[model samples]
Target chain A: MKTARRNKLKMNAFAWMLLFPSLIFLILFTFYPVAGALKTSFYMADLSTPQPIYIGLDNYKGMMEDDVFWKVFTNNIWFAVGTVPTSILLALLMAVFANKIVRAKGLVRTAFFYPTLIPMIAIGNIWLFIYTPGYGMLSRFLANFGVGDINWLGTQSLVMIAMIIMVVWKEAGYFMLFYLAGLQNISQEMYESAEVDGVPKWKVFWRITFPLLMPTTLFVSIIALTNSFKLVDHLWIMTKGGPDNASNLLLYYVYEMAFKFWDQGMASALTTVMIALLLLIAAIQFFGLDRKIHYR
Target chain B: MTKKISYTLMYAMAIIWLIPLVWTFWTAFRPKKLALSPSITFDFTLANFSHVWQGAPFSTYYLNTLLVVVGIFTVQFLTATMAAFAFARIDFWGKQLVFVLFLAQIMIPADILIFPNYTTLRDLSLLDTKLGIMMPYLASAFGVFLLRQMFKTLPYELDEAARMEGCSLWQILWKIYVPLSRPAYISFGVVSVSYHWNNFLWPLIVTNSVENRLLTVGLAIFAQSFETGAQWSEVTAATIIVIIPLIIAYMLFQRQFMNSFIHSGIK
Candidate 1:
């Protein structure tokens, strides 16, 4: 009994020793920066000046009334509204089709997923060419059918749609992987049972497969939501929030504030708000959406 | 009838997916003047490829990217493995709390950290260096969580056997745990490499000049320089150059890569 206790103690010590380096790194990089950002949000820190002035919620107050901030926020909502459901639905459809078909499954999956492996910056560059007005692929293709060239990235109304198309194209394959996993996890026995009962394929999907895949859906939604927030990388390359800030998302706005305008305080405040929004969404997923879904 | 409909749908979907890629490939290979032509003609040439190779410092970009990626992965692997082992096998007080703190890092959107990380980098005098870009990504919460889950599935008897053979903790990790966790390592490595390879924003913010610029950032600069109008051929050439390695890697390890994404999802 004493030896067992000693062994356990030794194991615990070893574990701590193993974990120490990672813990230190995490503390320095993740926790420290987060805390610093939170703190700096309340202070006006000028790089040229030595001391930070305590602003006491002024930055947050100013952000509340900032038009560009609100514009970016609304644009993000519009972006999410446009992209999320389409990507999810397309992913689900692709997964179902790929799962049901036996022939050329690997090839089909590769074809779908190949675009995803390409860097977003590269995709942005390619799409920029495709979206260019007269001498680009998209315009030329349209002109062949007696249709005139339409400004894709230039128009306010169509720019978000253009971004959404690129986003969905880049992301559907990734989300489909989750759905594929979910589809595989659903036993063949369930489908067979549904068939034996004379249930149609549609009904089987609606009743059995869909409900069972709710956890996967929730998981994918969280990732997709987070991705929607984080996917401003392409916007930097393609739009630069241009045509009078039509394509600006919240994070891009934050980048502009900090990097372009050099308003560190306002940027930090904006970042805090973004963080809060993310947490709220994460909370909703964890508590609300996830709990309502019955898995297994 | 149903089978035919499904086949048709599948083929249609495949074609839709292939269009952009086919366009890209065509633009890359087409003669410079014919790149944006309305009609498809097979006047393929290597001019664009040679132009891109000669015009840009692509070799330097590739080397820098490799160094940053490998450096980040090496540090992250060591740190994550050690942390995961502790979380899985240790009975330390406050373990759960510390683990929760680490998990919280997963939700912290990396963009929010850019300014502070930049400031930190500036303070360290590490800006524009490969190490500067890699430093922030050296400890990955996702990796820690993943390897912890893998370690938990491992039987404790193996540890016991190693201990009986007078193996120290490091020896046991190297001998028993590390070898057993190959799949986990491969999956994590795939995800990590692809992420860092495609990563743009952090590298963009940190690296000021071409000396340290990664491929993604270099591609962005190349794209940005064509402000007046789209240069379809040159841009497509650059895009292909940047993506072909990753595409080839994916093709070679398609199954393993898919499995890695699946494993990441499950974790």
Candidate 2:
């Protein structure tokens, strides 16, 4: 019996040994950097100057007062507001259509999903050409209807709209995959029973399919919200948060502060804020919204 | 009538989703002069394809991308498998807290870590190295969580049977668990490979020279020449070159790719 207990302890030790490398990586790369960023946010670093000055909450105070920061913050909120609901709804619609449709289902699914496979940078580059003036595809296509050329990216009001269009196009298909899975998990018996009860298809969807898909919807929403913030990769390549910072989301603003301006301290503070926001969103989703997801 | 309207709407939406892709393919093959002309009357040709092939070091970028992707995957598979086994099978102190901490890592957008990661790379003297770009991604929290979930669903009898046959833990993992979990591995592998292959921002920041640049970053540089106006044909040609392999892979394994996305979501 003692030997068996010894063997179990040995096995547990070996398991921890197996886990060590990944733990080291997580500590050094993820946790350490996060801690470092938190520390850095309290100091003011100037590249020209030799040392970083310890300024407690000054950066945060400065950010609160900064007009550009407020603009970018509001822009990110608007971006989330614009993107999350639209993309989720579109994804559900597409998934329902794909699920119900019997003909050429694979081909239709592939076509819808193809955009998600394209790299964001490539998408940005393609859309750059599409959004270009007279010589662009959109412009020429519009010309066929005598709408004339409009600079989609150049106008401040339209820049975010253009971004939303690109984002929705890229995201809807990806989210549809989740909804498709949710749809599959809902047994056909439920729908058949509903039909036998003389329930309308729409009502069946509302009462059954929609509730069943609530978990998937919540999961997709969290992912989409995070992605909306994280997807400033395109902004880096295309707009650089321009047309007067109208297209700058939080991540792009952080990128600008860190790399473009070399304000590491301010950048760290911005990153901290972004991280805090993400954590809050994640907490709410997991604790608040996820409880509503019906589990069979 | 309502069904007809909904079907028509679906078709219209699908068509709208497809237009940019169709336009991209058209521009990729269209001759240079015609490709950029912005007129619909232009004739298609293979000139842009040929030009793109001859004008750039696309082969190197492809090789670099493949190397980085395979390298990241190879490391991730091993690390995730081992870590997941520990989390799923082993009883240890602090297991719950450790798992929660690992899950929390998934929420922190990796972009936030770039500055410190850049500094870390600089300290390691690994700047401009493909290995450097792959380093941080080698052990993903997402992978660990995914594989752990998959491992839990596997029957305990398999492990017990292997142990009864005098198999060590590693041997059991190799002979039983790994083989049984092939679907999860494939799904994780597909997602991981595609992500690393299409990764741009980290690769862009780390790789300074042409030697190490992945296809995405290489295409970015090739497409963005600020001195001159954008060249739609050349850019489309480059995008085609970058996307074709993955597109082909997707077509061949369309079902698997869709399954991976589904599994990733539900997990």
Candidate 3:
């Protein structure tokens, strides 16, 4: 009995030994910082001062009263609303078209998927040229249609639209790959039967194809939703969340507060909200959406 | 007729979609004066490339990015392998709880931890270093989970056979398990490389100086120079410098890359 107990203890030690390095990192970077962020949110840590004054709930209250905070928050929701559906719809269309083509399918797939492979920063930089005021690619293209020069990224009304268009273009190709995989998994027999019934192509897509792609849509929606919050790399390159914070996102605003403004307290509070939002997403995915995603 | 229409539409969309990339190459090869002109002629020159090369220390940026990506991947590979082995093969107390904690970490986006992580780096005196940029990413929950899933799919008989051959636990892991999971490793490696290579926000916040800047940040600094906004050729050339390696690698291993993405997504 003692021998077996000692052997079990030895195995436990060995397992933990292997996990030591990774556990240290997970604790230090993720868990420790999360706790620290939560703690700091309650204390006003003026970096210039030696001691931080404990200011409980003030940071949260400040956010409640801040117009910019509300704007930034709403802008993020709008951004998600703008990018998520459009990208998914475009991806579904792209996948359907790519799936239909019998010739040069590889070439067509490449054209659609290439953007997803490149970095968002590169895409942002490229589109910065395209959105440049005069003599820009976008301007030149519009000018050919006798349209006047419209500052794409400069005007507040059009800035989010510009950001949305660029993001949709970047993300649709990636989401298309998921749809393509889902489309391929769909049984050919079902399509054959539907065709034998002489169903219209749109009805076939709506009734059979669309319903079958529900799991892919759910998966892609979660990804796209996460990305809408996470992807502020483009803002850094293109607008720097400028034109009166018109293009600012929740995470971007957190960054500006933490790094640029150096307000660690408010930043932590903002981060807490971001975490809350992420938790909401997790809840929606696991509880609300996962049941609907069939596992066949 | 429908087939013909689909072909034409697909081809047109494909061409339209690729125009930005094509436009990038076109503008990169053109001279500064003719880059924005409404002409279809290919007045190509390598002058923009030469100018952009000397304009910034791009070579250093490339080296820094290469080192950061490789460094993060190397550390991640080692840590993930060991942790995954324990989780997959070793039965230990609290293993399920520990694994759940790891999954929870995956849900917490790294961006949200920027402040506290920055403070941690500052406290450690590792600020403005490439290690700072690579540190938070070293313990990737995704990597550990990926490797654990991969390891679990293998039969225990392989480990048993290796043990009978007098192989140690470490040897069985590296020799038996690692060799059989090449596809998983390759897929993970490709995903990790692309992720860290193009990673901007974390690296942007961590590194401040030109010496430690990655290619994305370096390109950002170059493009942010408002005076050079009209210097379309040079900006595009700089952009090309940052993205060309990834584009070439993607083109070469297009199948593997796409398959890896597909696999990761479905998983």
- Candidate that would win on DockQ: 3
lDDT digits (tens) for residues B1-267 of candidate 2: 899999998988888888888888888877766766655775768788777777878889999999999999999899889999998888877787788777767888566678767767888899999989988887788888788888889999988988888999888777778888888898899889888888888898899998898999988888876443457778888899999988999999899899987897677
User: TM-score of candidate 1's chain B against its reference?
Assistant: 0.96
- What ranges in model 2 sit over 4 Å off? A292-296, B36-44, B226-230
**Model 2 alpha-carbon miss at residue B177, Å:** 0.6
Per-residue CA lDDT of model 1 for A1-296, tens digit only, reads: 99998888887777778878877777777777777778889988656535879989989988888887788889999889888889998899899988878778887898788877888888888788778888866888799899998999999989989999989988998899999998888889988887898998888889998889998888888888888888888888888997788999888887888888887887788878888888888778767887753211
Which candidate do you rate higher for DockQ, 1 or 3?
A: 3
Which stretches in model 1 have alpha-carbon errors above 4 Å? Answer: A1-12, A46-51, A291-296, B1-3
For model 3, the stretches where C-alpha displacement exceeds 4 angstroms are A1-3, A47-50, A292-296, B1-7
TM-score of each: 0.95, 0.96, 0.96
Which scores better on lDDT, 2 or 3? 3
Counted clashes in each candidate structure = 0, 0, 0
Residue-level error in angstroms, candidate 2, position A57: 1.5
- Tally clashes: model 3: 0
Model 1, residue A159: C-alpha shift (Å): 0.7
